[model samples]
Target chain A: MRIVVVAGGVGGARFVRGVREEVQRHRPGSTVDVIVNTGDDWWLAGLRIAPDFDSMLYTLSGQNDEERGWGRVGETERVSAELHAYGVAPEWFTLGDLDLGTHIARSAWQRAGATPSDVARRLQERWPLGVTLHPATDEEVDTHVQLAGDSAGEVRELHFQEWWTRYRAALPAARFVQHGIERAVPSPGVLDALLDCDTILIAPSNPVVSIGTVLAVPGMVEALTAEAAPIVGVSPIIGGSSVRGMAEACLSAIGVQTDAAAVARHYGLRRDGGLLDGWLVGLEDATAVDALESEGFAARAVPLWMRDLDTSAALAAEALDLALALRP
Target chain B: MRIVVVAGGVGGARFVRGVREEVQRHRPGSTVDVIVNTGDDWWLAGLRIAPDFDSMLYTLSGQNDEERGWGRVGETERVSAELHAYGVAPEWFTLGDLDLGTHIARSAWQRAGATPSDVARRLQERWPLGVTLHPATDEEVDTHVQLAGDSAGEVRELHFQEWWTRYRAALPAARFVQHGIERAVPSPGVLDALLDCDTILIAPSNPVVSIGTVLAVPGMVEALTAEAAPIVGVSPIIGGSSVRGMAEACLSAIGVQTDAAAVARHYGLRRDGGLLDGWLVGLEDATAVDALESEGFAARAVPLWMRDLDTSAALAAEALDLALALRP
Candidate 1:
């Protein structure tokens, strides 16, 4: 079986790890392609920092700090500290020393005129990672959050990182705008992977920014709904809260309640002009499954907390089973 | 009093330290402006690494590693090791963590349309570094060494770092080419500093690459000759050998023997359209002083080995005194 997962950074990284394990266990020869959100990618200190892409890369390569769930293991912030000493502000999000190696390499390749996808392929060549990673788009489509409470009449657009990391998403987001999304085409293999895969899984990432930004790429929605494969979306919002990250705040920005069923409804059935054939919610949110199923969707409840690799794999396996069962 | 010094990396840095100390002790309120060689600058992993400029910056700011004689006092190579793990080659010259911070800041400023001079000024503003640092040119003018023995029948050009660091200057250089030097204009304040200074001291740096590259700037030689202040050069070569760095090998590339008198003759008499009005040779090389004097240069013998700050200051005071005595 071939699987394609749409993913963000931390939570998506954990979810994809489970999916990779399930594929290795059940379909021994299957391939997995991850289409990662590049909306969080930005140029900081002349380095192209792709937070989501690096998180996936480090997690898959077994080099991610499991405790922090972000950045590389055995990382140092000497360079970051030095940058701070030089009075570079926005010091909230730190780039670790070991992580800088990847950014330095990627930035060099990107500045050399190679597309983001091309650089990703080159990076993946370093490790025997079981899955292929493709950026959502080669072009810059950064997610800018327009703050609702800006006293000035003019809108204040904050880079997704500033809003999410520095401010912890406390300031209400008036609107989430994926800058340059209209001009962004899906990276070379994104559309092909989504269409050709036997099953498509939307990892438990931010619905409004991660998956939403990916779908917003010009032809992405059309390609997903047109594909013959069944699409399963694992809810990031579970039991009236986010399992990881600030998905609750992101959902609130769009006037959606922090519940699995609400998120599933947000990504409605593909038959009803949306991108999901099935939805996977936490067992605690089991009641949400019945409500989703009533609206032409195949929904299921599972133990969604990825406490360990085994538990994560189990959740992924359940999601895959739902997709397979709903397949025409 | 205003002083201008032409400098390179390590040796130049040490000499500049002596000058700074001398100014602090004797002149009290004198200012020193350094026109540092940018020929050693190169792009590594997309970072703009300026070895000479950084060497001078660190030395004057009292942040230089006294034991290592280069880079920051406390530096970690975690990022560099990570880069090697990612298969980056030519890992000869390591960029330490703390050092990367400066490069990161400077590269960002340069990309944001600031000149190298502007970046230097901003960097100086962070530390109460009494001296001002200026690049020889704002534009790229990397020194490329043409190897004498390339099997391709054509001279192979290499970056100065590759020739100096990787090979340790073992390969006989057929010629030295300052790539992009022709189109290069002196960085802002370079010519003005040279022309307006009360004394112009040629630091004990490599004459061929360090001081030579500075003089190669289009109007630089004219400015130094036209300036009324006596241009005094302290010999990097003492007792028929280099005091520091690979001055002997660099001199051989330009067909000059490593001797105090020969170097003075190479710079020649300012009356005969050359740079120096006086030459400071080591006490061990006092025999060459008379020969230099015969060529119309006001030559003097001094204890040139900068063993400590006190000794370095004494040497700097002697050089300054020589310039003062030779002034018209």
Candidate 2:
């Protein structure tokens, strides 16, 4: 069986780890393809830093700092400190030494004209990461956020990282914009993964920006809608709050409420002009299941909190069960 | 008195430290300008690394690793090891973490369209270097060495660093070519430093590359010759050998013997269409003084071993005395 998972950084990485674990245990030989969001990629100090791709890569390679939930384990920030001291890079977005190793390697390849997908392939080749990772698109599709009420009382556009990392999503976000999404097409293998997979899982990543940005790539939405595979989305929101990250802030920016029912409706049923065939929410949000099912989704609520690999794998197994049950 | 010095790395840095100390003591409140050789500069991993310029900067700023005689005092090679693992950069040319900070800063400024001299000015402002530093030229004048034989027996051309660092100058070099020196012009303040200074000192650096490349700049030779200040050169060679570095290999490449008299003749006398008005050699080579004087150069021999700061300063003082005696 082939499983394709859409992922962002932290939440997505954790969820994908469970998916990989589930595939390894139950399916035994299933191939898992991960289409990672690259909208958060940015050039810092002339190095191309793909936060989502690297986060997933490090996590899968067992090199990620679990305590930090991002970056490499046992990493030092000596180089980043130097960069800050030189006043060349933002002090807030610090890159650890081990993390810089990845960026430096990727930037070297990029400068040599390798596409993002090509660079990702090279990186994965170095590790025994059983899963295949593909960027959502090879094109530069950076997410920018417009915020309201600066000191000037005027809207200002910031790189999504600045909004997310620096501001901690505190400033009222007017809207989110994928700067180059119009010209972006799914990276090579992305459409193939979606079309050929037995199941497609939208990870518990930020709905409006992470998964939303992946779907924003030209032809991606059409490919998913046309694919025969059942599309299952795990709700990032649970009990009127984000399971992780600032999904509420992102949801509110798009005038959507921070609830499982609202999020399931946001990605509605594929038969009703939306992306999901089934939706998974937290047990606490089980009350919203009937409303989602009434709207044509094979909706269910499970213990969605991924406290460990065992719990996360159980969540992945449930999502796969839902996808199979919804299959035509 | 405004003192100007032409320098490279290691030896030049040591010499310049003494020059700085000498200026502070004897010519209090006087300024020292350093015209550093950039021919040793190269692009490694897309960052501009000016070896000579950085050596002087690190040495003067008191950040240089005294034991290693290069790089930062407390340097780490984590990033470099990563680059090597990624097969992105030459493993032979290792860049330490703290040293990379300077390169990152300089590369950022260069990419932002700031000239090399402008970057140096900015760096000096951060530290009380007490001396101004300028690249000999802003142009990329990388020195390339042509070797007589390889396994293929065809003359192979290599970047000066490749020969100097990787091979430790073991290969028999046919000649040295400053790649872009033909069209190179002195950086801003270079000509002014030479023309306006009370005396010009040629630090005991490799003559054929460090000082040779500087003179190879289109009009640099003319500027020094026309300047009223006496041009005094301290010999890198002592007791029939180079005091440090691969000056012997470089001298042999240019068909000059490794001796004080032969080197003085290589630079020749100012009246005889060459660079120096006076030559300073070690006391061990005092016999060569009369020969240099007969060739129309005001020559003197003094203690040239830079055993300590005091010894180096005394040598600097002796070079200045020779230059003063040669004044018209």
Candidate 3:
């Protein structure tokens, strides 16, 4: 069996871990491929940093900080402090010494003329990550957020990291823009994974800047609407709130309501010319399932809180089952 | 008074510290400039590294690890370990986390169109290094050592760092080659420092790679021969061997004996189209003083072992006194 997952960062990493666990236990010999959003990537101190890819890599390789919920375990920021001392900018987004190793290698490879896909392959070779990780696109399509209003009348736009990390998303965003998206093509193996997979699952990542950015790639929507596989999405929102991160602020930026049913409707039903064939809401939002089905989504309410590996694996199992049921 | 010093890495750093101390105590209000050898610098993991400049920076700022003889006092190697794990080349040359900060900042600034001099100025701004440091040349003239012979009939040459760090200079070198020296000009302020200084002193650094490479710059020898200032050199050798590092191997590679008299003759007398008007040797090599004098050098034998700050300062003061005595 082959499964393809669309993902972003922390939440996405955790969800994909669950997917890997579920597949390893029940569907032995199955291959799982992840199409990770690279919109959060940017150049800092001349290093190419792909936050989403690093999050997924660290989490899958079991090197991630479980307690802090991000970055590598036993990490140090000595390099970052030195950079600050040298007056390098973007002081808010601290890079741990271990994380910097990855960034340095990526930047070196990129500068040596390797594409983003080539770098991903080289990085993944360092560990047995169980699942293949492919960038959403090889082109640099860093997401920049336009500020809604500024009383100072200056500095109205910021890279997604500056907006998210430096400002903590407090500055209302007018819209999220993916620079270079027009010239981007799906990374090697992304389309193959989607077209040849038995099922497709959207991990519970940020709907606006994460999964939304992935969909916004010129050929992405066309590939999804081609009916290659049954697509099911797990709601990042449960009981009208996000479980982690600032997905609510992100959804609000794109004028999407912070509700399970609203998110499902945002992705919409494939029969109605949208992306998903199935949608999974949390048990707390079980009441929204009937309305979602009435609106043409083969929707189900499941326990969606991925508190531990077991709970996460169970949630992943429920989503896979829902997608399989919707398969023609 | 304006003083200029030609220097290399560890030994040069120690010598400069003494020069700084000597000037502060005796020649009050005197300005000291150091022409640091950039021949040892090379790209590692896509970072522009200048060892001599960093040594001067750390030592002058009191951030050097005195016990270890190099790098920042409190240093970590987490990033280096990660690079090793990723199979990045030249693993023998490990970079401490703190040291990497300087390299990253320098590489970024250089990428942003800053010249080597500009990078050096910006880096020195972080710490009040008592002396101004300038690269020998602004161009990337990294020294490569051509191996004497290879049994495999391959790999005839290696970067200086690879030979020094990886092989520990055990591989006999045929000759030293500076890749971009023909097109190189002295770095900004280098020729000015040489031409306008009241007196010039050569630190007891590696004569072949450090002082030799500096002199190899197209305009450097011409500037030295212009006779604007009296030039004095302190022999890097004592008795029949180098006081520190592998200067002996480098001397042998260039067919020069590792002796104070031999080294003085190598620099020769400025009257005969050479660089030095005076030469300082260790008290142990006092017997060679008369021979040096007969060969047109104002020779002096002093306690040249820089075992501590006081001794180093005394040696620096002796060299300055000798140069002043020969001021014509």
Q: Which candidate has the highest lDDT of all?
A: 3
Rank list by lDDT: 3, 2, 1
Q: What does candidate 2's lDDT look like per residue over A1-328, in tens digits? A: 8889998988998899999999889989999999999989998887789999999999988999999778888999898888887778897797888788788789878888999989998898888698999999999989999987657767789999998899899988998898767889999879878776788999999988889899899998887777788999998887888978888889999999998888878877788788889999899998989988887888898999999999999999999999888777
- Which is better, 2 or 3, measured by lDDT? 3
lDDT tens digits, residues B47-76, model 2?
A: 789999999989999999999889889999
Q: How far is A67's C-alpha from truth in model 3 (Å)?
A: 0.8
- Kindly report the docking quality category of candidate 2: medium
Rank the candidate models, highest DockQ first.
Answer: 3, 1, 2
Candidates in order, TM-scores: namely 0.98, 0.97, 0.98
lDDT by residue for model 1 (B1-328), tens: 8998888988888888899999988898899998899989988878888999998889888889999888999888888887777665358988898998898888878888888998888888888678888998898888999998757688888999999999989889988898767898888788878766799999988999999988888878887777799899999998999988788889998999999888988987888888889899999988887878887889899999999888888988998998889777
Higher DockQ: candidate 1 or 2?
Answer: 1
Give residue A145's error in model 1 in angstroms. Answer: 0.8
> Number of clashing residue pairs in every model?
0, 0, 0
Question: Candidate 3: where are CA atoms >4 Å away?
Answer: A150-155, B150-155
Residue pairs with clashing backbones, model 3 = none
Clashing pairs in 1: none
Candidates 1 and 3 compared: the better one by DockQ is 3
Off by over 4 Å in 1: A149-153, B150-153
Better of 1 and 3 by lDDT: 3
